[model samples]
Target chain A: MQNAEKKCAVKKCAMEKSSVTEKVFMSLTGLFLCLFLVVHLGGNLLLFKQDGGAAFNAYSHFMETSWIIRVIEIFLLLFFLTHIFMAIKLTIKNKQARPVSYAVNKASENSSWFSRNMEITGGVIFIFLCVHLYNFMFSQRFFHHYPSMYAAVRTVFQNPWYVLFYVICLSWVGFHLIHGVQSSFQSLGLRHPIFTPWIKKLGVLFAALIFLGFLSLPVYFFFSRTSRRNVQSAISHQLKIENGFKRGASQ
Target chain B: MKFTLKVWRQKNAQEQGSFVTYEVFGISEDMSFLEMLDVLNEDLTLKGEEPVAFAHDCREGICGTCGLFINGRAHGPLTGTTTCQLHIRHFKDGETITIEPWRAKAFPVIKDLVVDRSAFDRILQAGGFVSVNVGSAPEANGILVPKKNADEAFDTAACIGCGACVAACKNASAILFVSAKVSHLSLLPQGKPERRTRVLNMVKTMDEEGFGNCTNTGACEVECPKGITLASIARLRREYCKAKIKG
Candidate 1:
């Protein structure tokens, strides 16, 4: 009996450790992803150089070939997966915590809509990530579908549907970051009277910068002359393929 | 004045609950929220209907006994004030006020507005204390404490364990309450001896009580009657991390 009691105590302690440890992992990985976003936005800014994708393509090439970046890419993938897994797990537990909800919850009175709807924002961002990775990362790394990374991005942005989706997703990213950034610091136990308020303001600023910085690329490319030319050429290219197939079938 | 009260009525934990509406009249703006309820109950008693079962004691708001989710806001539409202290002036005449008990898995409804808050007591029993020898009272100034630490500790210690934080949170998390206890004790020299074990054990018990994790929404801080801040939660995390690392 005493041995069983001791075993129970050990299990309880382990459970306690994991609960806190899970939050720590969530915070650390989230902060790392935030850092990755800064670097990504910095590199993508090369698209605005007006050199018709030369600077951006060169930057992409370097990003693809660098061994350090390759290593960081693996860690980044791991962190992203861990973050999603922990988020889902914690969300499930949180839902279960409140089996009975209030009949009339004026939640807006106390918390922001974005703060309360993190799961919705996060889920939207995750969906966007899958589409984004397929469009750019996977295509560039393995498929080599276009002449250059910038060409691929420009082609994708030429589609009004894709551009609209991209803009919406980036806005969700902003929403996620607005809450996630400072919340990460709090989870990591870094709070100060003077600095915390500053951190909160900085979090909002960082989110806005990321939102606008990434937003400018898609909006710019969608309306740019190059993208329109690319779209017309793509349409003609499709016509040529169809016409050739028709002649071959007729023969 | 007249008002319509939509109050949550639950017979017991085993029963399903729903909102019951009652029309209350002759309510003055000067009457406290609980006093308004008292008038309603008096009317209900005179009418031979069962009076609304709500918890209240030490109506001065110190005992943390009275709690109501009034009109969707915890402890009514006031900031840093308990339900007992909230007056009818905040509401307009003929307005419909919604009142419900704190909702959480760990805090099941015992009756109408009373929840079983023994879960808090259990968590407190886990480690919300310091050990001292059973003898004559020790000198208060024997241990030196920084003024800032004392003030912070006092601020956090103001948490009355009313479960308002839990009610206000979207996830019904108890982190604010637990962190308040953890921060209040851990900040003082008297609470230093078993600081590590205290945090670990209290957190363990807290999780076992089925409370949710803190998502840092700041709702609890805003809804807290005692005005406990989220900084205590940060301090709790700091102490928790330090304890775990040291172990």
Candidate 2:
């Protein structure tokens, strides 16, 4: 089967090609988005306490108003888009490659389970982001204009079906974040012998904390009461003011 | 430690392959993985059975010839190590091990353990190198590169042309392998002369060779015996972009 398939002199030069730079791009984009997730989780946790919706809304509003954050957010969005697009392209290309592996294929047994599941996890999270934007961003930014942001917030999550949808999104986001955080380091060349163990543990700790914070919101909303005190408590607890604001903010 | 080996045996490239089971007694833990296989091969020869065919060279682990798929992982259970260098101590007595070869579309089995890695050579021919002038070699100090960039490029250069990345990948992508080669030359002055043509030609070659695209699943880096990063692939994208823009 040794047909004479020859490439050009320079083209066949194996001395120069390796994937270092592309790994860096993948790492930077993936890590930056993880930072975005942390900030997002911080705001999402506020949804758990009383006045949570209004509080979360105010936090969202604050993020929108900052020029620096606005710029960063745009970049963050771009990072998400680029990462997804690259992932799709790369995956497709790999799929079209050779079929049967060599008898002595090494390295396939030693990889981690999480790293292997990136495609499944990434796809899940991508779907979650789209649904999240539809429920919170699209409705609030584009739909019926209510004078109070709190009213819009309460109206969305108060519905049992919507609350359930948000819950599912939060869980999948958590799954994606766990694998994403560590894989980013692998891409960036951070897998040094001594630090690898510590870094992996650190990633797990961080992912768990962030996931719990984000997951609390939908859980809190499910058990909400319509009492005026409920609304007041939500707003006061979420905004972090002591009692007596008494503004009706029910779950 | 002695262990039970379940190795795939194929009569030829076109013939059907099957797992041939054997038990090796009193194996030394310190012996390299290949040494243990050697002992077993000796046993097979005396028994009048065909000795197992496995690929290995530079038992020091750098030539990229050893391609054992052990226990479902590439290069056995060790992280960042080739089979020839992997110690037998990683296995326990009576443990059953499964051995196979590099599996991919472009790589076909030539014998028992060896596959046609010439696809990589083919890919390289497609434009993996920089075409510099045939004049006298440049003086050692002619090109001054930042120490950091040099170090970084060297890290990518560590890839041993082993097809582990291809085997570990679910999609049989050679992105990590190709990226390592691409990034090494792209970073240095010696590689600059043909940078534009290099990217364009190599990418076209990669597509033509039937290697799959990178999905960023990151299995390649995890399974690499050299710990080659996926970042090299990112640099490939940038190079591709620059090439596209220039064209």
Candidate 3:
């Protein structure tokens, strides 16, 4: 006999269909954010130049003044929001799926600890993002004028607690990235024997590079008193230029 | 060999279960795992006590009915062996074996070690079939399948609905089981007609059955008796994406 047909409503079908859709959404947004992180790290490397912050301040200035950068910043914020939203949604769905737990869980033998705890790492990174945005992007208390991104960054890194926090957060970001990149590729159905191992290696390398870039900035500024003094002088010089521009405009 | 068994003992589905330790003595090393349990049951019955209840069909490993969580590894410590196929010699003498039923919200323990795996059957019923006209066996030469694809299909088709993957997974995910079914059929031409709807329906049923989402831990793959690969799950992912985008 032919199998009897079962009818489910279109709405129900759509609801069921969205888990795969959610995965696709998370994978794409997460990969795009990875690209954003690479670009961010590249820009952040300017913090290390010995030009007394001129290169970094100029780069920050261009980023603030360019219309394209401003538009991309908005899009970046949207991407972050969507990525976090999908993560939370999928996490809740997964938790609900397994209402009962095993009595003796020996899960570490089968999977990496980092892979199992993506939500925790993602949570830490989100908290760090909020503090980072407050210190550099949204709050004007740290630096009174535009193009003071260098001063704000240097000032924040000077505090020992902030440095420690930044290092810890970057470590978490590294953990999240190492699992996320490969996972997103698999979620997108980009699995292959030859390329899978290489992709995993590349993920680790990218994570290490980003980790080093973020970590070095804090470590370098925290210990190098001379560099801190130089950054102070550069900030004063930039403030002088801002005052001059204001005075010229008023005149 | 002598062993202390800490078996999860529950009277029924409603009763809360607890581990009860039993001392099993004079166990033979040559006995299969189930045979050892058979000896334990025989002793319990002779003592006028209720014997430990577990499921088993074929004494051989093919039936997939026998399963247990021995010492935190599915089907004991040996890789790619079912519970029935496991021999007592592998387990050290005088060791305390912590045996528990497959713990998941979907697979509720019925008595002792036996769980209601009907959830899996429900998932299979959702979309595990291909629509074909009722007829005698069709000639095998009507459709041409590459040797590699045929081999791969046969490999995936070895899954026996054992529920070991669910028991082994940290999240209790049935993705391996469902994906194995999907991969085995979708690899051949006969299964092409319903591939899209099949995956979609099967996945939806899997979710509805309260099986956990796959976290790609590879636990199920490591614990699978048939050595089902994670590649099938990847194929499931590919099929799912294709169905959602195109179908």
TM-scores for every predicted model? 0.92, 0.67, 0.89
lDDT (10s digit) by residue, model 3, range B1-247: 9999999899999998899999999999998989989989999999999999999999788988998988888888888999999999998999998888888778899999999999989988977888787789888698899999999999999999889899888668898999899999999988997787788888888887887767666789988999998889889889987776564
lDDT of 1 by residue, B59-165 (tens): 99898999999988999999999999999999999999999999999999999998999999999999998978899988888989999999999999999999999
The first chain of model 3 has a TM-score of 0.82
Question: Compared with the true structure, what per-residue lDDT tens digits does model 2 show for residues B50-149?
Answer: 9999888899989999988888788877779999989988888789888887777688777776788888888788666766668898787887999988
Highest DockQ scorer: 1
Error of 1 at B19 (Å): 0.9
Please give the lDDT score at residue B161 for candidate 1.
91
Candidate 1 lDDT tens digits, A11-118? 556455545667889999999999999999999999999898899999999999999988999999999999999999999999999998888889999999888988
Candidate 3 ranges beyond 4 A from true positions? A1-16, A140-147, A226-251
Q: Which candidate order results from sorting by DockQ in descending order?
A: 1, 3, 2
DockQ of each: 0.59, 0.22, 0.38
Q: Interface RMSD, all models, one decimal each? A: 2.6, 7.2, 2.9
Per candidate, native contacts kept equal 0.69, 0.38, 0.40
* lDDT scores of the candidates, listed in order: 0.91, 0.73, 0.85
